[model samples]
Target: MTKRQSRWAKALALCLLASVASGCALPRSGPSKSEIYSGSVLEDGDAFVVSVNDRVTRATSVTPVLGFSSEFLNAGEVGSDTIRPGDTLGLTVWENVDDGLLSSAGQAATALEEVQVDGSGFIFVPYAGRIRAAGNTPERLRQIITEKLDAQTPDPQVIVTRLAGDGATVSVMGGIASQGVYPIERPTRRLSAMLAEAGGVTVTPEIAQITVMRGSHQSKVWFQDLFADPRLDIALRGGDRILVEEDTRSFSVLGATGSQNRIRFETQTLSAIEAIAQVGGLNSNLADPTGVFVFRNEPESIARAVLGRNDLVGDQRMVYVLDLTEPNGMFEARDFAIRDDDTLYVTQAPFVRWQKTLSAVTGSLTPFANYSQLAGN
Candidate 1:
């Protein structure tokens, strides 16, 4: 080979090496500064901008009852008091007018003091059999039973009574202290009473969020509220259930942010920033402020439905994205909430992976001792 050709080859090799190294500076396949500031990913038409400093306003709009809007408004009531089908109905029958003879009287083993509406929407009674109790009030049910028993008993003195079933009894599920069914038969029995019956919440504080489902409506009940207010401390029903989810046992928090760990929280509601803080903030050397990503679980069906597909019904339907690059981002972290089973992912800066690749290449070129030294923390 000619000397000039050899020199050209060496020069070309140097140029190639330089280009490969500088390629790390290529525009990253990530959100840029402009995109971070503009929030272009959010749907424009129906989206609401929540600034870091925006005053947090909780939803106060109660679900409006269809076909009863006028009646509900004219009654000047903000919330409905009418019992719903899934709502608990506690019936207490006074045992005064039982048959005088032992043969006719209700036996302790046979007589049901309380009945629960099963999945079929029917309450199984001792002798009267399964009654459609979902929509009927205690008085209405008593009347129905009275009419049914007219042929057997004369004058059939029947007394229909209803006490609060909000806290009649419930079983503690998930991560609770003493997880079991408990009876709470009192007008003022608070949620603490039931939790106390079940021992208490699990030892871990990470999965401490308590959930209470009343029929079809599920709502998050704060640990404090179970004992805070008697009024808000809803009464338990026969079939009511209290689920005390464990703290985030295995979760990932990422971002231009805080802590990053596979941590658990006893409560379900964690703020976006709080989750980041839990994991350990962005690696100062490798974090891209504009490209922070939170890879949360999205309900496939809900997403499809919201995207205009009607076939997907009753699916969990939305994704939440938070950008912490804003000036007042800390407050947004405080107000931006999170749900259970969510994943917060903070993508590494482009230079980080490049550094890792370089380290690996160097390790391969070195002796075992040098490789170990490079890998040593």
Candidate 2:
């Protein structure tokens, strides 16, 4: 070979060796042993690592913090409105004899009159004086009045009806189309019926986010499930407030995925596989099939149960790795539930890093090699 050709060949050989060395030095595709067990260390905190099977088992075993059964939701049922303070009672008294205290000599029965229950829950009656009206139902108040007037009037009869009561209404607000206070006119007025009376939820109702707040306790049920399951269409109570709001539960995708953003759950429940699909799945060219990970902050109770470690670190955070290269991994992903605010990360494949390094070296040398070729010609 000529001197010029030999020199060119040596230069090419040096470039190839440098590229190979750089490629070899690139980080491996899979996580290191430390990273697999303890997770990639962050500036603020360390991520705890767990296997996919362990994560699935832990997730399946976890009891939901927020859930309501038909029976539990029905427990707040206000079957009938009981008289309460601020209620106006329509009372009528009758006696066989004309000249009774409630009725004049010319009339046998007294006309119905409105009597307001005071703040102390007592209503004034002509003969019965101040009577307790708050805790009693309308029927019970009628009986109480008849017994109290029995001594003064002969064969006295009494009728008690609630004209207006504050406790007889339920408020429907939030994402509903028509927000208002609906009256519970009947004994069997259910939650679903009240929501319907308020013109139903607004456009694109997030059924999974419906909440019923009664007194100090609150319960939640999916709007669609409330309609589909008759049992969940629980009877509503007086003073109950129903709120329909957008679904706030979300998970985030990061690293080598197609996109990195927080995705809200469209349904009541979302699985890990579905969450991945929401972010456009993993990047085929860059993602490492064996290095998919999910990071979560677990409740202390669940963390203790799953890890069996008394160490507080186990309770604070957990990292779950999924090997999508395996066929069963896809199945397991479908079954695994993803909770709110979880982080899903797909690491870059080792080969991808090596390829990028080699490509960079070759690209940098191309102009130099071209100049050498021209000079030789």
For each candidate in the order shown, give its overall lDDT on alpha carbons.
0.49, 0.74
User: Candidate 1 versus the native: TM-score?
Assistant: 0.45
State the number of backbone clashes in model 2: 2
Residue-level lDDT tens digits of model 2 in 280-321? 888898888788887788887677666666765434677877
- Judge candidate 2 at residue 312 and give its lDDT: 59
RMSD of each: 12.2, 5.6
The superposed Cα distance between candidate 2 and the true structure at residue 230, in angstroms, equals: 6.2
Roughly what TM-score does model 2 have, to 2 decimal places? Answer: 0.71
lDDT of 1 by residue, 44-141 (tens): 42322232234231211111111212221132211122222333544433333355211245631123344445555676544456677655656677
Reference-based lDDT, residue 154, model 1: 46
Collision count for each candidate, in order: 33, 2
In Å, residue 263's CA in model 2 sits off its true spot by 0.7
Clashing pairs in 2: 29-350, 207-223
